[model samples]
Target: MSGISSASGILAARSALLAAAKAALDGQTDIDFYSGWQYPVTQPNWVATTDVHADMDPANIGPRRSQDETITLGVSIGAWLPGHTEDDIVAAFERAFSILNTIQTHIRTEDITLADTVLWCVPGATDSDGAVDEDGSGYQVEIATTFVCQHRVRAA
Candidate 1:
């Protein structure tokens, strides 16, 4: 029998990552000068709502082993602007993500080392909500994406 298993964890140092991302994108900066969209901070689903802080135990009895964990930060971007293409939304997110990495120094973290990345989502549309702009478009072509920030440190 192969007794092997793995565990993960994401110390809830900053559980408000979602809200923070939304706010950040709704700003003006060099990193946010792309995507060709106005700064209204649309789409609230641009942040990750689900994550896991894993810790795996060594299936052996030797000296000792420390558990490993990481903060899987996710982000998504949606647009209600009619006449907009999927590429537009993605470009906006890329712009926002770059800005995020630049100002992420303010956020608190337990682990000193951390990694940043944006997860890609499938290309499609969702149920119509309500037209915000012209074209009478109710649904939003969400350029949803996620980020996994790895870290290992102490909380402030």
Candidate 2:
């Protein structure tokens, strides 16, 4: 947590994870990965929202003074095209799968474990107007995932 979000510290974890998510989402290597991603500084909406604290107490496992704490890092991807089809949806998922794999690799490299990481995808329209088109055929695939990560205290 030293860097916490600095360009060179552990705090930049969210940035790191965001990069990994994009890379994992796109099945292509970034020619200029650094410039390709513009990781916004850790916003109060993103960082402090989660409880990140750790301690070294062997007995803190069985039970704690407070309730069990948890945090979730949610990732989402979406697209909208006039003529999207089923194949497009499949491709979107395939891309997401690739990105998720790379994400796991990056996490392991940093010695962090992903807990309860789940992927959910669906297709829908973006029109805020609730009116069914008489003759409109299009598709959109959106992927939003939540990676529940926790600072493990003990094996128990």
Candidate 3:
């Protein structure tokens, strides 16, 4: 039996999200991980990241060693308008929330498969709801999904 490492699981999760988002959203949005671009200004974009602590389980030491892992995938969506008015901010928030919902729905219904490893992914809770920025740049919304991947350590 082969075991899937944490690094591989993270990569696969990211790839699956990017593909799903692009396919569902007509390929008009940008997706990346650990990007340096500023939020709000970079409208119609998503940033993907893995929660280091929330997704890992301690290794089991025994014959047929296996570990239960939960991979938390975060997707942050941002949108902006070039006005300072209250209406403009509200519009921005609505736009960002719309995109966020679209992404979330796609992940929940679509079938995500990792080509390199045998892993299972399911939609999890969403956090960091939409909020208009005080700086008046725009609004930002974030949604997260947990993917449970079962890994078995290969015998040495």
Candidate 4:
């Protein structure tokens, strides 16, 4: 058996995450997913973005020296409000937090699989914050979470 490449491992991790998030947000028309922080001028009410990074260090196991690679993925969910009133800001925060919670729960409960690879997903820390525009015309809330994925490469 040949070991998988670092690029393959990262792609596998990202694919798993996308599947889980889609299932979690089922029936939510207002939600959208993006590759990076490309905020639109006419932004939607809610947005979820995915960013993937791989660690260079690899761990070897057993006599065959099977390799284990780590991939870290960051997911950010944002909520936008039309106004900067106290009530609007609070509502935006609530929406962002709710989305984040749903994501975490779905990830923990779901089994993530990748073809031709042994995968393990462990969720990491989470954070949230809210901000208002200087002109007090708009408000935004953001919540983020990190997932650490360990992929075991096949041994030759």
Q: Per-prediction count of colliding residue pairs?
A: 18, 7, 0, 0
Better of 1 and 3 by lDDT: 3
- Over 4 Å off, model 2: 2-13, 22-69, 79-82, 109-138, 152-156
Candidate 1 — which residues are off by over 4 angstroms? 1-16, 19-23, 26-48, 51-65, 83-139, 153-156
> Tens-digit lDDT track for model 4 on 1-156?
122643447765676676677777888877776656665634444545467777645445546665677778888888877798889989898888877777777766765442333366767777878899667788988777787777765444
Off by over 4 Å in 4: 1-8, 41-43, 56-59, 112-118
Model 1: per-residue Cα lDDT over 20-110, one tens digit each? 4445445643222222234555443233333333332344322334333334443334433333356645544444445445335333332
> Which lDDT values do the candidates have, in the order given?
0.35, 0.35, 0.52, 0.68
- Encode model 3's per-residue lDDT on 13-132: one tens digit a residue: 566655665665775645443322343344444544445323445665445554555555555555555664668767766766676667667656664443333355555665555555
Best TM-score goes to which candidate?
4
Return whichever of 1 and 2 wins on TM-score: 2
Candidate 3 shows a clash count of 0
RMSD of 3: 4.5
After aligning candidate 1 to the native by TM-score, how far in Å is the CA of 110 from where it should be? 16
The residue pairs in collision within model 4 are none
Residue-level lDDT of model 2, residues 100-131, one tens digit each, is 44555655553353211211111112111121
Q: What are the TM-scores, per candidate, against the unseen true structure?
A: 0.37, 0.39, 0.60, 0.78
**Candidate 2 CA-lDDT value:** 0.35
> Native-vs-model 1 lDDT?
0.35
lDDT at 104, model 2: 56
